[model samples]
Target: MYISLNEILKNSIFKSVTILAGEAGLNRKVKRISVFDCPCNKDILNRNTLINGDLFITCLEQFQDNKDGIYDYINALIMTKSSGLLIVTDDCIDTITKDIIKICDESDFPLILIKEDVPYAVIMDTVNQYIAIENLNAINTLKLDKIMYGSVSNNEKMEILYSINPNIGQYLRTIYVDGGFDSAIEELKTHILYLNSRDDIFVRSNNYYIFILSADDIKYLKHHSDATALKVKEFINNPKVGYSRIYSRKDISKALEEGKRSLETAKTMNMSFQEYNPLSVMQLLVSVKDTQEAHDFYEAYVNAIRDNVSAENLKEILLTMEIYVANSGDYKATGKIMNQHENTIRYRVNKVKGALNMETDNIKFNETIAIAVKLRILMNEIFY
Candidate 1:
């Protein structure tokens, strides 16, 4: 990101200087700075060396007697696409005329005034230092972005990961947020700063703001009874949040997919946040990249139930099973979702198990049934 002229003025070296005009141009980017000496022979208007985005700084000593020349100089700087102008004023050229200020305001061209005592070298150094920092930040952000999207080569990715966090452990977890772009960025930055995890990188991908944090750090934040974590949760104004399971560095692509899947699930379920569950049949279904394979898997799992049960009963059973799996097989919670007594839920579950002819004690049987139920739901979402 480019550093705006407003930020340069906030620097300690330039803080004492006054912004005389062009408040609207404060956001103009300063890419380079140059000292414009009043060249006697060179045509200042036609043959000026200043480029489009350069910040032109000058003493304006030559224009002391020829005030009209100042107007011409300002016009030339504007025509050259100079980012802004900084003029030194004192006994030599103490004041900018009303006409020059008027032209600057009309053009929305930044015109800053510095006291003559403040050496031009100081201003140049400060602006250059800021530009350098901004450039470095931009480079780092691009590297991190490439890593997030799995675009970096293995060697380069490892180097960037090491540079970002030398102690990067065995696992990484991604937190993806959707909505409240600018506010969420600010709040998340505050939260990360408070946690003292400045090494973590935040990047915008598509419509989501993806935050990459160490798995251990996220675990601490989620489980530890820290006020900072609580404050972070309160401050994050996002409408939907998704978190991926811990994964090795080599599985970053899978981790990103899991994060996106979790986000989609959160949106579908109208949830504030959702974490990817490795055991979730929905997650498994989403993991299958080929649509045909996913469809075939769905058919293999659901064919038995569809053949054995009536259409209406299958719908009821599927709903019951979905609630059962969602509630972690808790009969009481599933009953609440079905708006029935615990005994009723048990009866329906037993009936469904009998119809499917599957042993509840068999882990594979239960997993297949869960997948079948989820697949049916997903199909309904598609066809309906």
Candidate 2:
């Protein structure tokens, strides 16, 4: 993204500069800065030299006595759609002619006057640095966006993954936060930068922010994650936090899936945070989709429950199983937590069992229902 010309004027470095003409074009976006020092004779070269949104700055020393040369330069700038022109004036290049400024006004182009005392280096550095930072932010966020949406090429995707951490076979983990206001989200990003020793791959995807940390980055962070949670609590009364299981970047899609499931699991269990277990029975069911049979097994269960019931009952079954699994299959504990009676909780469990024709031991029942509930929760959290 390009920063506007008006923003540059407010950068404090351009305090002495005067807007002699072309004030109407202050909102023009600038992507780069160039010097308009090329000989006025190279009309063809100058026209082709500048890219769109490039702002040119010069003293016009070579064209000091050539009125025609000055006019040619301005015409070239206008033709190339330059952001603006900054002319440094002194005794040698005392003034810009009325004709030049008049032409600029007609085109709604910006004409800035920098005092001779200011060096060209100052203007170039400030504007280029600002543009570079904005471009970097674009690249950083866009790469993650492509991966999240599954649109990136394999080579480009590997470049992004390996860029975060180059060590071989090391597991990368993603820490995700769900749902925060705009201000709170920005605050969370700034807080993370302040808290971490070095920058990690931080990106805002949709309404949530994700920090994909290297294994090394997570070393002291497991401890600091508590501190991180406190920062979250400041914005969210009871934040839902989820971090993915250790996985290679090759399995990032699965990692993202489980990270989302982790938070949904947290919300369902009435917990503040959840670290998804790769060994989770539900994880196995989700993973089964990677192969035809596991795919069939997982969907067979999820579709059976989701399709047979009304939306209201499906909602109830999910909550009931979530509570049932969370309480370790203890009916009384689940009831007490839900503020419902033990018989009521049992009836809900039986209602789900009836949906699936489940006839099994308690351990089997716990694992199966746990998988079903998580798959549903994950289904809700999936985003493009």
Candidate 3:
């Protein structure tokens, strides 16, 4: 971000400077600083030499009592789109007139009054430093953008990372944010800077903002998972977010794909965010369509339950089966998930077996039942 007049006002050298007018334009970016000394030379205000966003500092010595001359000068600065004007009074000019302040206020142009005791050299030095820093930040942002999404080779990526942070280690998580207003995106960036101690890098790709975090940082976030998730949901302005599993920089491309898939899942389920999981059978099955083959598979295995069980009981039994399979057939774990006793879990398992007419003890039959349960759930979602 470029330095603004508000930032300049915060400097110690400008602490005594009073804003004569144009409070609305304090946020105007100052690209460069120029000393306006030639009061008689109107040609100096030409667009070729004096560009927009230039901050002008002047003493108005030549136009000491010529109010019209001063008015003409201020008008020229406004026409050239100068960011702001700082006038050193008590040197050659006594004070700015109400007419000048009126013009500035109407134009929404920044007008600052500096005491004559404040030397112009100090203002020049401070503003130049700010400009230099801004230029460096812009260059770094460009490099980061190329590294994240451009067609840079692996060797180039390594070199860029080394240049940015020589001690850069593995990036463990990729956070992808999709769909938000530009202002919301800016707010999210500000929040990320606050949370990551301003060490995180951000880049825009298509419709998403991608953030890569180190393993230790990811661990810290997971440790404060509840608070972090709440902060994200609150600050991101309702964007769909996807978080990928741990991965090294070498696998960034794959990690990004995982994040995209997770985002798709979150959008389908109307969730604000989702973490990628490699072992989620429901997530995998949800990708299947209600085709003839899938319907046939579901019927062949789950027909008895679908035909005989009530709708509410069918939902409960399928949910129980899903938890059972997800927990590797650990009935106690499934019971905890279902908020029931182990005996109740056993009763449900027996009901499922009787309905399917299959032996639960047979490993092959159990596997088939798991697959059938997943397909049946997916079909319900598709058709219902």
Candidate 4:
């Protein structure tokens, strides 16, 4: 829910700052900023001076007389579970020694040095503002989350949602990413595809990035899924994504469920992304996998069609059949992909259909076999 030091240090204001040590602990969350104006010593670093998750910003004036006080300060930071230290160097203490950097690295306490010219007010403003906005987004996301996933009445949910985005139309859509992160709320904020004007709600829950986009924003993605997917992968590292169809506010639970189920389907199918369709063949493929149902369906459709098949040509025949089905029953294209003659592919396609006592011309035949082909793959009927 809090912004990590790693996130804040990315600001342009911190670009001039040097990260001296403890690069590994950059993900530590910053709950507050502590500016050290008072003398820093063991007595001052006691429990009363700081709490957990405090990031200390100091001028290093206190340590000018005894610069090794940096060691005691760092040890105190580790003991109290503080976030890290940002030292603004002055004339008296213009740089940190290697020994202190080693201590910071060993203790996993971030040590930073900044120019004395960079105003503390600017640093505090930049870091604290990031903290504030991130905290606010987290709060709003949680509130809407309760209204969405919790058992709140429809009127109340609508009212709260209206408060956040007055233009929240009849429809809302969700995108779920399996990329877990601490400060994902900013993902919605920073992405070019998402607009602050749109009031998108993003949150990290159960190690997944869940965000709800308004119907207006869904316009960009409804039919341009590939483009949207490319953009998501561009930013999100090709994560396993399940995006829901546009649905009403009352269908929030169903929308989230569709996203979850579609993501599951993508994982089971070894795909990077899936868009949920209630009547999709993928939906049917996912539904019947529990217990002995997959085996039963495979036996009735795939194995039945698979009967009288030779063990030697089984791999080729199954591969050709899969290509044919994926190409929408186009034997010619399937042949091109398989680098075989169209006649050969058509014969293999008919041989499978003829065994099932069906013809290629029937509309439902393609749908039926599509399910069977996917089920065959899902059940691992063939070695490949």
Candidate 5:
């Protein structure tokens, strides 16, 4: 029996009661004891620290003092993996003791209160009986820690949706469209719409128009691309289940850039009409998937490229590009931000293209990759 008596006066009242209890064959089975909330004494350590059947006692005065020592004793019990009883009693239950009680509540530490007329022998017998029965309500709760660990699986996807607003992350609607790839696009739209018709999802696809109930649904659909591709290659899956070879985040980011560019160009032309911008799409994206998709994409992409690319190299380009793109290729400001000669920055840009294996001096490709990098950071916020 490894019992800890954390009483302020364990020396006087506590020890006398314990000795009497032991004489009455109450603590006869006791192996170790801990004395908490007592004044420190090095002599006490040498005399009372038991090795085997000898009674071992540790005195901890303050809550912080008890923490490490108590944790060690608990961990020792856990390591041994034994069915043991831990008893904690104090003369005055202060904030520290209250906190200790909270820990006990959370941890399922077997607790017994010392009350008037409750003989120590009876208490000891009761504890022995409880131990024999192996009361494990706390152990059951401990098992829940494992169950609560890690990320949610595909089965949990719908759990998240319904956990929020039942109708929020999904929608059901129909629309018409007229434009290029009309028939193929219509089929794709119809397919998405049909998929969304289920309670799990919602879709609206027609001609040049496309709409989805939830961003999560779109992400899920996009993830299915790899699965769809595998199924098609192995089983000759039909167009109804065709998979696009597009990474969802990449495609979304590109579309966002296109939208922003369109809006900016519209502004240049003094046009009232405009499409969505990257920032607007970002807002919409957050509203739907709430960053989960972005995080997943970032983690995957970063892990994929980290082996080949140095973070420093990417950072350098990003820093220089900030000024260059801001000033619309103005060398002076770009160089100033980089703290390098304008020519040096140009040289570095050329070097970046070489490193990335970009041909024909395609700055658009560089820009695309830059956007991808930024998207990675955005995705990390959602995923990992």
Candidate 6:
């Protein structure tokens, strides 16, 4: 139960602070606590509350922002060889308290919320007794939001995590590496850097280091598993040293050859169509071996539906359908988004069915067509 002393003080009043400090006082043998001041001047009076404790209580809250400062404090705690709290106090609830709750839920920090009415004697006694209780802690979904909002942007993290977990990509900011970086292939590890489009590299922390590399680059690193991550981190951290060649010399040539082959494969697989939006369809068709047949089937499907389908009308229908699927077929919400009565949407959808030669009422069929339409738009853009 490693806790930040600052978090405990930030959320409660002077009375609660006294209770917390008193309980901590009972454990004089445990002298690793580090105390920091809240940015607010009002909370400075509580500094004596933590005096003569494990570590001195001053200038600890260096991060100005509540979330940033709290995270900084947490990182400092992890850096230290102690198992105690860091006390920080502010007059009211704010980012510090929010972040503290976040960290408490994310990792084990044993957060004990103190109300002003609770006497210090009762509170400390209760906390000491209740502290032994394990597994009563709650895991809220808010942790994910906290991680995103409190921590650094997810761009670099997403790029690296996507290699191991692709499903998290859409929910995160992506990191992209320039294809032109191939010229410095040998220094790949040493000079390996991933940045958002704006070009800020992610700094690694105890929990994570995020880097975005192309699929081809990720594969290359996987091939040279021995020194991939370490080399990449070194390169990103010290790009000026130009260690790019040192770590990547052994596999640069091989990686370059593989990268070229991958590019060619991707190019060959790209599908295009001009008459209709077929982007999503193009992705599906790329995997299909019989491209000519796929093109013919798509053309036929479009021709049959074109006369009845105006671009705007089809867009509305498709957008509604996508929303429906995204909402798991919430008819009321989907209808509202379509700007048509639910029954009218049902009717238009029925008409779409007659044109597509499928059962409109069938959930599976409608879902499939909706997906296909999305694909068609993407494919058309690619081809055009």
User: For this target, which candidate reaches the highest lDDT against the unseen true structure?
Assistant: 4
Q: TM per model?
A: 0.53, 0.51, 0.51, 0.71, 0.24, 0.28
Each model's total of backbone clashes: 0, 2, 0, 0, 7, 25
Instruction: Rate residue 97 of model 5 by lDDT.
Output: 48
Clashing pairs in 4: none
Q: State which candidate, 2 or 5, has the greater TM-score.
A: 2
Cα misplacement distance, residue 99 of candidate 3 (Å): 1.9
Mark the 10 consecutive residues where model 6 has the least summed lDDT.
132-141
Q: Write the per-residue lDDT of candidate 3 for residues 1-384, one digit (tens) a residue.
A: 676777767766776787888989999989999898776346676536677899998887767656568777788878878899888765654546888889999999998888747778888987877676556556655666666688989888778756644554455456777765344234434534633443344445445665655544656645443344455565566888887776676665566667767776676666787888889765666566357877787776556766656776877877777788879888999999889998888888878777777754657658777777667655654322
Task: Please write out the lDDT profile of model 2 over residues 260-345, one tens digit for every residue.
Answer: 77765666556777888866664444443345554454567656777767776766667777878878889999999999999999
What lDDT, from 0 to 1, does candidate 2 have?
Answer: 0.68
True-structure Cα RMSD, model 1: 8.2
After superposition, candidate 5 runs with Cα above 4 Å error: 1-315, 322-328, 361-363, 380-384
lDDT of model 1 at position 69: 69
Model 6, C-alpha of 268: deviation from truth (Å): 13
Give the TM-score (vs. native) of candidate 6.
Answer: 0.28
Shift in Å, residue 8, candidate 4 = 1.6
Q: Tens-digit lDDT track for model 5 on 1-384?
A: 132222211322233332211122222233333333344344434564423322222213343434445544433432332222323343322322454444444543333333233344544443333332222222322222222342555345334434322543332211112123223223333444434453322212221222222234555654442343233223221212211122232132233234334433333334433333345543244333335665564455444434444776655655565466556667777898778899988876565555555646687645644454455433333321
Question: Which candidate number maximizes TM-score?
Answer: 4
- Model 1 TM-score, 2 decimals: 0.53
What's the CA error at residue 87 for candidate 3, in Å? 2.5
**Candidate 4 per-residue C-alpha lDDT over 1-384 given as tens digits, one digit per residue, 9 for 90 to 100:** 787898888766676777888989999999999687666566765547788899988877777677776667777788888889887864544447888778789878898877547888888877777677667667666765677578888777777767656765456777777753333334634532333545455555545766666554556536444455456665565488888887776666677677777877877787888889877876767767664977775567656555757777766876876788899888789888989999999888778777677765666667667776888766667543
lDDT on C-alpha atoms for all candidate structures: 0.67, 0.68, 0.70, 0.71, 0.37, 0.38
Q: Weakest 10 consecutive residues, lDDT, candidate 2? A: 375-384
Total backbone collisions, model 5: 7
Better of 4 and 6 by lDDT: 4
